[model samples]
Target chain A: MTAMTAPQTAPAPALIAAERVRKTFPLPQDHGGVFTVLDEVSCAVAPGEVVALLGRSGSGKSTLLRIMAGLIPASGGRVLSRGAPLRGPNPDVAMVFQSFALLPWLTVQDNVELGLKARAIPREERRKRALAAIDMVGLDGFESAYPKELSGGMQQRVGFARAFVVQPQVLMMDEPCSALDVLTAENLRGEISDLWQAGNFPAQSILLVTHNIEEAVLLADRVLVLGSNPGRIRGEVQIDLARPRDREQPRFKSLVAHIYTVMTHPEADMTRMLAEDNAEVERFRPLPHARAGGISGLLELVVEQGGTVDIPRLAQRLRLDVDDLLPILDAAVLLGFARVVEGHVSVSDDGRAFAEADILRSKELFRQQVLARAPLVAAIAETLRQKRDGTMRAGFFLDLLDEHYPPAEAERQFATAVDWGRYAELFEYEADQERLRLPEPEAVAP
Target chain B: MLLAALAIAAVLAAAGSGIGIGEVGHVALLGLATFARVVVLLAVSTLIWTPVGVAIGFNPRLARLAQPVALLLASFPANFLFPLAALLFIHAGISLNWGGILLMALGAQWYILFNTIAGAMSVPTDLRDMATSMRLRGWRLWRDLIIPGIFPSWVTGGITAAGGAWNASIVAEVVSWGGATLTATGLGAYIADATGRGDWPQIVLGVAMMSAYVVGLNRLVWRRLYRLAESRYRLS
Candidate 1:
């Protein structure tokens, strides 16, 4: 067998590039704060290639296309065409809207001639070019017919003829076939493909936005899937399936399934990384502080005296905020070490039985001791860091403490009247008098 | 009356020969029928003309041409020209009754022509474009598009022309000149003679017969044609 060699072809440069683009809207405070509809998204389309931006409704795909077209400005980032920034709708770009925006009073020939007329082409030449474009779209004899006289498909063909007459470098279709019936849409697609292959038109690239996944798969060189809730690029699937692709092929189904999985399960693989990060953080930090006793020793003090400890009371005793207390409680709940119900916290029956009966292994005892010491020790370390050799300003110190530690812990650790009073009076702090009065030192310290 | 009928029937038979509607045998029958029909047709046309003429006068385009034409014809005082009509008929060696019918026909023809043209000119732009885009041009365009486009005006003009013909008939039928005088026995003559003798019953009968013929012909023909045109041709 003869040695094989790859075919030599010139590489096409990127014609359109969108980098870290974002669009957002300020929501009414009544409806719940500012809502981001599109977050930072990046995409690029090469010359002569067709790319389909696919998404469900409200996914910001059309907004992105509009931004790329320079019809609207993006709230963040930039879109560049041929290494130059896109400012507004360029003369080299033409867009076909879903509604065929043909002027009713104008005949097919006049509608087709609009773009050239706008450019101030001479009348005779404009007519000639208009007729040629009309003929190309197979509307040869309908030059004088007005929009109302034509069928829907024929009207869309007039729209196509209008766009084609301009000979723009980029043809952006905003769901051009969505309004047409399937057969008409298919015929239009075929006509578009044929025209592109013929290479007579100036439109070097086509960028289509569509909700139909199969349409994207059928028409695009690459399909970009956008996900909702602050829309971002979920995945890009290269459609290497041969041109004139069969939608019935198993390979196509597999590719569609892959896209669906990427769109639906965005955080599937992220969960493992998140869990690993949590483990590493726990390994480096010292354990939480526990009372100087084993489970039985603690049980004797609380249960033997018929005492109670819910999440809030436990948080109060530990001098921790509700937010900081929640993760620890969640972990404890997950491990079956505690039970919380009806805003009341308690040890589970199994937890109580285990505490009383378990002296099973020294390692198990050590683990429980570490778990109990973690929160209190972390809070103390944060407070020390805030104190900073006693040189930090009091107001700054409280802010630092609040940042690092929970509100309850900050309140307790910095409870001195002199410390809080000077800072509060400086900032005009409003303190809850009943819950957090300055302690009388002689009464509290002894 | 038979002589007037025979005269109109000869003219109609000659005209009908072009369209192949009849031959000589039909012409003989048409002579009697045409005479009676001319009298009836004249009376009927008279009653229909005034209301339809007013409608035509209100039309924008036709009113410009129709106002002057109708006024000129209506105020011409055809009755004063009986001696002239008689002298012409005798000098030309044609029957006087033939001249009478021709004069009546000319008076009616203008109403139909003006109204028809006005309605045709009033066709909307969209419908015009629809016709053009369909490549309707020339005679086909005239027959299929223009004729239908102005049909209501044509009907209106036809009704007005009918009345004009009746009004013309009185002056058309009576004639007097030096040593020559002629009169055809029709409703117009009957009305003239009754009025001359102050015969109320005869005058009332002539007027009543003419009014009945006008109402009957309009209800039977013009109304139905107008309904069809309004339904089919007039743009909403």
Candidate 2:
């Protein structure tokens, strides 16, 4: 790994280091007594390096970022700043939150001066530094304005000003652009990039958490991708593109595509393991957010576009995030309906046939495919069939997934399963009652 | 012309009956005395309860414990406690003048306490964290965060306490239980004295003066402070 990436092989003088960090939140019942957010995650931010932790919603990138920032502690590992263990809020490390985190009653000047005040800086100096910071962030005339009076972008600028005023050694930003519009986000991103390249800011290094792959590629010197369900580093790419990197460049687009490909398709250890063992396949990796309509609609789109399409262009046209679009792509790959390679996804013969078939015939094809290929759906069907009433609580499946994934992700995965099961006419879901029942053999078929 | 003639005639008749200009000096002085007692009682309540109220407000368990107990205490009528206070004052031979203020405070202080507790709770966790991270502790922490956080609540409490104080004076001053009577010289005592003597005109005069004082104070002082507190100390 060191030989491939263009950087010093040995660890350089580090600004902030997190070694084998693990964070686990306690579950209510003490079943396992823990819910793992990140497991055995090791990373170091050498001086002058901006590292981006890029992951989707449940990937726990923000948790990892906070642990490194000393905002939260890791359950099992050491987080050090300049070789000192971080026991609490470190003055050397400041965080800019996505929510702006400004006290509503405080003026812009007061909000910017808060960290300094906390550090017990004298009045005259705190005021001077705060004003300078406000000016630096282009908020000069708005010193007395309250947070409630400011626009979202202006409030975020105040957030930036607050962090910058502290002159921290390590600045951690948790998706600072996430709450702003596209244009506003782009504008802020450009300003930060300018500050970073010009060495105009105090922090020697920054730890940025973002889900947008393009943002990660655009801002970071290196990007770390975390896998879901006990988030651990899945892949790391050192972005070697020159400073002021043009988004229109082929190299930039290719890098974005590379990150997208890695995000959408992880090495399917569960699939490989299940294929090898062929026993108790229900205990395989938890389901993705693959709804029946999205899966079928994606297949239909792939078939219509000559059975092949550019993944990025397809995502842009469909207006689906990689987080949303990846699961559908993964489901297609799982059911042998499509094969995704490089930056393109192509439909298989069965997928093409399903696209050509009538709605009833397509659902019939879907039922056969899901029951044969997807273990979770088959387990639900089997469990419902075994019950005397041919029904079970939806919570039964949810709890099973929760034992492996986070409770939220488990709930979402089970909902996806319910949607697929219902659309395929294998199971009937009563949402208001939250019960799943096997469909009765119909007297009249449509 | 008839309305003006009738008003002048009514004024002349009232003065001639000794229920007019002569009583204004006496009634106005009595109103001032009662106003002074209300002010003193409010000061004492502020000094005693601000810290206590803020303390209970910040502590969840303490706030929960105190809520029902304070409400219970506040709901217990001040008139019901007059007998016990009356007995003590008579046995100790304590002057009724200053003692009436204690009864006034008793009737009023809980309003301040509960309001401060509410304000203390509403101080957002982020502001507290900002203080802690800044290493602000002890008096500075209280001065910067707790006081400002409770200011709006304190103003609300003060308004209610002042109103309660005025009402309590009617019962507090000129306390009577069975055969004994303890009297304090104020509008309340004046009212009681007139009632005992069956002087309906004096009773109306004392009541009208007390209402004027309470309403005037609320309009001139509290309304302004409440507005300032809402703008300055409210942590949205």
CA lDDT of every candidate: 0.59, 0.80
Residue runs of model 2 more than 4 Å from their true location after superposition: A1-11, A268-285, A331-336, A353-356, A372-407, A426-446, B1-236
- The A-chain TM-scores of all the candidates are 0.56, 0.91
- lDDT by residue (A170-246, candidate 1, tens digit) is 77777778788878987887777667667675578888887666677777877787765457777777778866667
**Looking at every candidate separately, what fraction of the true A–B Cα contacts under 8 Å does it contain?**
0.00, 0.27
Cα-based RMSD of the predictions, in order? Answer: 28.1, 7.3
Give lDDT tens digits, candidate 2, residues B97-131: 99999989987999888888889888875455445
DockQ (Cα-based) for each candidate? 0.01, 0.20
